[model samples]
Target: MMERVHVLVVAAGRGSRAGEGLPKQYRVLAGRPVLARTLEAFVDRDDVAGVATVIHADDRALYDGAAAGLAGRDRLAAPVTGGATRQDSVRAGLDALAARGAEPDDIVLIHDGARPFAMAELVARAIAAAARFGAAVPGCAVFDTVKAVDASGRITGTPDRSGLRAVQTPQSFRFGLIREAHGRAVAEGRHDLTDDAAVAEFAGHAVTVFEGDPANTKITTSSDLQAAELRLQTALLDVRTGQGFDVHSFVEGDHVWLGGVKIPHTRKLSGHSDADVVLHALTDALLATIGDGDIGSHFPPSDMQWKGASSDRFLRHAVERVRARGGVIANINATIVCEAPRIGPHREAMQKRIAEIAGIGPDRVGITAGTSERMGFTGREEGIVAWGLATVRLPVTAD
Candidate 1:
């Protein structure tokens, strides 16, 4: 069996350098907390078996609110309280994992919770390198001339730029090796080490260097946070809109399901699924925006397994497809066209349900209703129809 890969996110810093008030890790970046994005980088992957976050004892409420909407938050171990220093924080995380039954041979990646842009490819490289060598860290070659300056503000020496590489986490190691190294440091009272790789090196472990992405920059100041926001906007340059329309004939039933809500009605919509016209239209709209065909192409009526299935499943699938393509649902506007069933009472419920399924805030979803002026099928009170418009933001290359 392959050894499990665990991640320890160190976020216990005071972050005084970033700014006043909230800590940098809890700061909003590209619509979410930096720590939440960093956690997603590890927890979203199948190769990672578990995740542990080390947090400041005073920031429990902040961490909880920031990480409330994370997709796989249940996979995270109960957060442990960090210590006075970065090294101490890492040791606390390691100890937490050990208490939770992490094996000695399991791979541990110690990451900075402030760096939210660590890509999956970079993580894979670190894992591969750590498996080959007992310890490894991600590094990028220096492109600018480097100078070592003294406290007097004079250049002490100009180092060879070609030989220097700027390193970034997550620093990977065998669990036993890093734990022992940290223990040794504690015993010897060596608490000044900056990174985990340095601690491993101090313990006489040969640390290998792997390729690191320049985009995986750490947020240390207000300017760094602004730059990260700008970078995210630049990457998500491709925005597209898609419209979907779905109709279902009325059948004999006391209640109708619409947008995952059950409403008392004289007749219900009929279809292979739960016949939620609102959700069906929203699902197709999301899929169309991502160029992933329509809802029928994914959950065809010909498939018996989907018979009487809740339409929320279809909507959830469409949302996941958008995420897989590095896209986000910027806004969702759905309208229900019906004559008999009044939708005003259930509009808020519908919006909340759609927002939950799409992994976005309820404010981003809009729900409205209309009548067909007593002309067509909906006007004749024989069926209901729904139309949805979806705006999606995707990475430019994803187009």
Candidate 2:
């Protein structure tokens, strides 16, 4: 039997050094919260079975808002309130997992919530090393000369640079070993340990090191955050625009669904799905942006699985495809062409629904309604039409 893999994300630090009024982990990085991105790195992986986050007792509301848009919230344990120090927080998180029935043999990766750039390949290496040696951490080879400095900033003896490695997080270890190490440290009044690897070493466990990515940086200051943003900008140099148009004919019904919003109408739109014209168009637009064919290519009308399905599922799938390609949906602008149902009262709700489905802020989603000058099917109240324009930012890859 394979042991389960769990993750502990320590995020209780005040992060005063980051120069942010809010906790640095809760600060916005790129477009989403920093902690959300960190959680996503683990949440999207199939190898990760569960995740637990340790946060300060006073930061419940902040944590809630930061994690509101993440899809992996269901995989998270009810967040454990952390202690005064990072070590204490990790212990608290481990305790929470144990209480939730984590076995002694299970593997746990302790990661920093501020380090959002950890890649899946790095995590895989850490897990492999831990499984082989019971303790491991990802580290990068030091490239610059090392010099020791005294308290007065005087130069001391230089250490051998060839033997130095800059260690990173998602430090993996067996559950029993790390728990015992943490318990021993508390019993011995040793609270000055800097990282989990140090704790294991103090407990007499030999830890192995695996190769780490240079981009897996911890955000400690404002300059670091700016640099991360610049890196993201460089990677996302390819911007593309896609347009989609959808039309649905009228049917005998009391209401109609548009952009996931149900409005009372004299008639309804007819299709295999809920016939949400707005969402259908937006989904197609997103698919086109990613060059993933159209909505019909994914959910065919001939397939009974999508019969009377909610169009929101299609929209969500499109967004997931964008993320799978290391791209972000910059904006979605949709226009509803109808003459009967007054879209004015429900425009805000429509935008909010689109944002939720796209995993972005509502401000980035735009919705408007207009008519076809009483000339087309929409003007005649025979059907509704929707036009969508999607702007996407995708990572540039070498062709």
Candidate 3:
């Protein structure tokens, strides 16, 4: 049987260089958190037995928010609090694994939480190299010219690029061996070592190298984050737009629900559900973008289970369906045609409610309200009508 490998992700750094907002690991890449994507890369692998993360003492809330939906996964361990340095943070992660009964000779791969693009093939290579050589790191061939400069800013020497390599993580090692190397380094006051390989060499252990992918770039600056965003957009090249429209007649009530928000009105819309025309139309539009069945097909009006249900549930279900197909909702726009309630006063509230339900920003959800100039049922104040448009991005897959 193949041995299961443990993964340790270090995310304790403040990321001061990445800018002034949240830490780089907690920053949004595309739509999801960077650390969330990194954790997904390891959690989705069957070969990974467990995953642990080291975080700053004050980042528990941030980590929890980043890992919100993944908290239930059995293989994800509770985060460990890290110390001042990167080496200290790595040791904290390793010890957390040990406390959970990791064996002495088991393989452990330490990775950076900011590097979200490390693929499965690279991880497989790291695992094989660690099993064979006991200590291994993934390294890419240096493609640019190498220059050694002095502190005085004078040109020193140009080295051969052919022999140089740019090392990246998932730096793999035997669990017990790396732990002992770290302990020895601490005991001898060797706190200046930068990486785990240096600690291994200090303990007289030979480390080998495996092929690394250039796409496994770490996000350290604003430019890197922008590049990652472009890469994600390019990967999801299949863009689709879908439209939906729904109308509901007026009923005797003091309030009406639109776009998951309740507004004071002379009468409520009449339908099988809460009669939220905006949510129903938006849900249908989102489903259409993913080629899923319409809202009526998923939640039939004839079904007693959907009677008087909140329309937000329908929209949330459509969002889940889009995600299941590996699709991202680029934006949603809706126009409500009603003369009675006056939609301008509640436009921002409607947009925020829909954004919350769809897991997107309010800026991505647009809501506009206008009347039919006394021509249609909406202008006659008899009912409400909504037209919805959804733009989605999906990966191009084999048919």
Q: Which candidate is the best by lDDT?
A: 2
Compose the digit string of candidate 2's lDDT tens values, residues 143-255: 89989999999998899988999999999999999999999999999999989999999999999988989989999998888898888878898999999999999999999
lDDT of 3 by residue, 53-87 (tens): 99999999778766643322478889999989998
Scored by Cα lDDT, where does model 1 land?
0.88
Candidate 2 residue spans exceeding 4 A from truth: 1-3, 56-81, 155-157, 250-255, 264-268
- After superposition, the stretches of candidate 1 with alpha carbons farther than 4 Å from their true spots are 1-3, 11-17, 20-40, 43-46, 51-89, 143-163, 184-193, 201-204, 248-275, 301-311, 339-353, 373-384, 397-399
lDDT of 1 by residue, 1-399 (tens): 676899999999989999897899988766557887788788778888888999999999777755654555557777889999999999999999999998899899999999998998999998888788989999999999988999998999999988899999999999999999999998998999999998998888899888999989999999999999898888888999999999999999999998889999988889999999999999999999978999999999999999999998888788778767777667899898889789999989887777667666677889989898998888899999999999988888721
TM-score of 2: 0.87
Give Cα-based local distance difference scores for all models.
0.88, 0.89, 0.88
- Model 3 RMSD in Å is 5.1
Better of 1 and 3 by TM-score: 1
Report, for all candidates in order, the number of backbone clashes: 0, 0, 0
By TM-score rank, best first, the candidates go 2, 1, 3
lDDT of 1 at 240: 94
Q: Identify the leading candidate in terms of TM-score.
A: 2
lDDT of 2: 0.89
TM-score of each: 0.78, 0.87, 0.72
